[model samples]
Target: MKKTLIIAIVGILTFSCSKKEAEKNTEKTDSTNTVDSINTARTKINDSIKALNSKNRFRDFSGSHQFVYQNDSSPKYSGSINFTKIDGERDNYTLSGNIKSGKNSVTLKGFAQVVSAKHINFTGEITQSIVDNDNGKPYTRKGTKTFMSKDDGKTYRLQDMVNGSGFVDYIDIHF
Candidate 1:
């Protein structure tokens, strides 16, 4: 009877110790997975910044793009914008293009300064023509725009815009 009690106590101790060890191991694994996920996200962002910095910001920017206005209810404007001139040393460029959607058209001429791999500041004048029914009127506006990339520089978003009136937000840009 004494031997059996001793054996039972030993068995319980062994089982308890093994269970505690298993829990510890699971905690370690969970912690490691969290760290790994964080590292992966960091790597992706870093890769995007590197890719953006390596390319000619001016050349790559010459393409057809779609701009969705934050405050407008109309569909997005699609057009071709080109950087006609660039100063590589100063990271400045001039762009001119026209974009249209429905009866609204915009002619834009602008200069952009590359602030970093992920950001660009633009100052431009836009001649916007809107046709209400059969009548059309053109208006000119000057503004400053800030472009920022969030997803590893795969695309850029127009985060802020300052015109004569005030600041505009939530304008999305796709390249």
Candidate 2:
């Protein structure tokens, strides 16, 4: 009877230990799955952000733009501006263009920061050179311009401008 009782107690202890080990393994698997789920969520969110940044409004503004000075109704300096390159992402972009205005023309290289879909701020250097009687003399000008769009970016009204030559009070720009 003593030997039988000792065997029964040993059996119970062994069963209890095996059950505890199984529970521990289950807990470990649950923890690992939770970690993997969090990592997957993070990767998805990061990819979405990257995709949104890649498709910005600047991409739509690429091409040749013809602009007329609204304030000068006499058409003193009507010009066609051609964009050669536009680079960057989101609301910030770097642009290079050639602007021809009557007897004066310049190569404009600039950076634009979008305050909103309807507002933009620009800083650029204008380099000009004389090639013929119609062209202006060689000169360089640095300028900052702020523009606001009243028609949902279809047309921009120049609110203010400051440059090396002087400050232009306000003018309208349409593309």
Candidate 3:
């Protein structure tokens, strides 16, 4: 009877140890799978953010849009802005736009340097041609100003930074 009881206790201990080992291996596999999934998720999220930044940073300002000046809407000055990518760093761009209202017209040529996500420094010229010689004041070329996007990134608005802004409040380039 003593031998039988010893054998029974040893059998129970061996079965208990085997069961515990199996549970430990299962836990290890589960933890490894969880870690792998987390890493994959992180990589995908990083790729998405990079794509969005590239899209918003560089844009094609195509399609016709009205250039509103000093709340004037009698006859629309319609034009489109074009971007020629500069050869240097990614932040530099050659900006050009043209608009016309009857015989009067305007042309904008500038270098747009990105200052931040919300601002750009435009240093260039706006030349107004009055073919009919209208008596209205010319846009007197406020050559340098910071362009800000008023409607998110759809329209970039620039205004003269000084007083007596030549009857021009701002110009919206639907970039």
Candidate 4:
């Protein structure tokens, strides 16, 4: 009877030890799986960010254009505009230029920020100046000629959102 009781106690101890070991192994496996999932998610997020930056790099807005002012059938004035790319979350250009006809000339300064794949907004507010085409009576021209434009890679087709029938004299900036 004593021998039988000892054998039974040994068997129970063995079974209990095996069960505890199995539980420990399962905990280790669960922890490893969680770590692997976190690493995979982090890698995916980094790849997505790199792809976004690469796509934006091609939409660079940096160049120079010699602009000739045309009033009626003749080129009344001449000037140059230079667009310099400013690197940041927003893709844009700082514009600095002028239009000159002999001794008389008008200067321009502003910035244009990309609003779409083919559109940008211009803000000519450096000087806070305005031009009246003819006399000071009609508020014809302001520091900002066009608020928006269509950008087709090479050139910008200026859009005067404030154009009207009475607006006979207009400023056209093609680049």
Best by TM-score: 2
**Model 1 quality (TM-score):** 0.47
Residue range 1-175, candidate 2, lDDT tens digits: 9999999999999999999999999999999999999999999999898778666655366666754432211233445554333343666666555546565554656876777778877788656543342234565656877769989777766564332234242233455
Ranking by TM-score: 2, 3, 4, 1
- For candidate 4, lDDT tens digit of each residue in 67-169? 4344342345656777787754446679877766544444557887776666666777422112333331323234544433344544454555232223422
Estimate the Cα RMSD of every predicted model relative to the unseen true structure.
16.4, 5.4, 10.0, 6.1
Clashing pairs in 4: none
**Candidate 1 wrong stretches, greater than 4 Å:** 1-72, 85-88, 130-139, 160-172
lDDT values, one for every candidate: 0.65, 0.61, 0.65, 0.58
Clashing pairs in 1: none
Clashes of each: 0, 0, 0, 0
Please report how far candidate 4 places residue 74 from its true position, in Å: 5.8
- Evaluate residue 44 in candidate 3 and report its C-alpha lDDT on the 0 to 100 scale: 100
Q: After superposition, how far is residue 124 of candidate 3 from its true place, in Å?
A: 0.7
Model 3 worst lDDT window (10 residues): 161-170
Error of 3 at 35 (Å): 43
